[model samples]
Target: MSELIGRLIQPRQPAFWFMVVLNALSMVLAWLAQKPELTLTVSLLIAAFALGNAALGAFFAWQLIRRPAK
Candidate 1:
């Protein structure tokens, strides 16, 4: 629905998208290097970052939803 789309594409959401892109690029570079240990480490870090970003976005959405209407 349009409402769900609005919630996802809100102004503050760009930071999360940026983080995702950066992590994805790092993952690709790590993969290209062919180092198992480094790849694993980067993967774990990206997972953590993703979780954090999700939490942050959820918190922001909740705040936006709860704000009294103008």
Candidate 2:
């Protein structure tokens, strides 16, 4: 619904988007490396990074929502 979409698009701390960009760049570099081992390592690292970021973002949003209105 619109509520979910709004939450997703709402701006938050800058670190979230920075990590996303970093992960994307990492993926591109991995694809272009042309080495099987390096690509595999980078892919795994990027996946871990993405999952961690998601968890962090969820925690931050939950905290924000739970804060009492001032």
What are the clash counts of all predictions, listed in order?
0, 0
- TM-score of model number 2: 0.45
Residue range 31-68, candidate 1, lDDT tens digits:
54455655666766766665565566566556544443
| 1-70: candidate 2 lDDT, tens digit per residue | 6554444443464544554565565555545455565666776775666566556656655543444322
Residue 10 shift from truth in candidate 1, angstroms: 7.5
Query: For residue 7, what is the lDDT in candidate 2?
Result: 48
Quote the RMSD, in angstroms, for model 1.
5.9
User: Each model's TM-score, in the order given?
Assistant: 0.46, 0.45
What is the Å distance of residue 3 in model 2 from its true position?
9.4
Model 1 weakest 10-residue run by lDDT = 61-70
Error of 2 at 29 (Å): 11
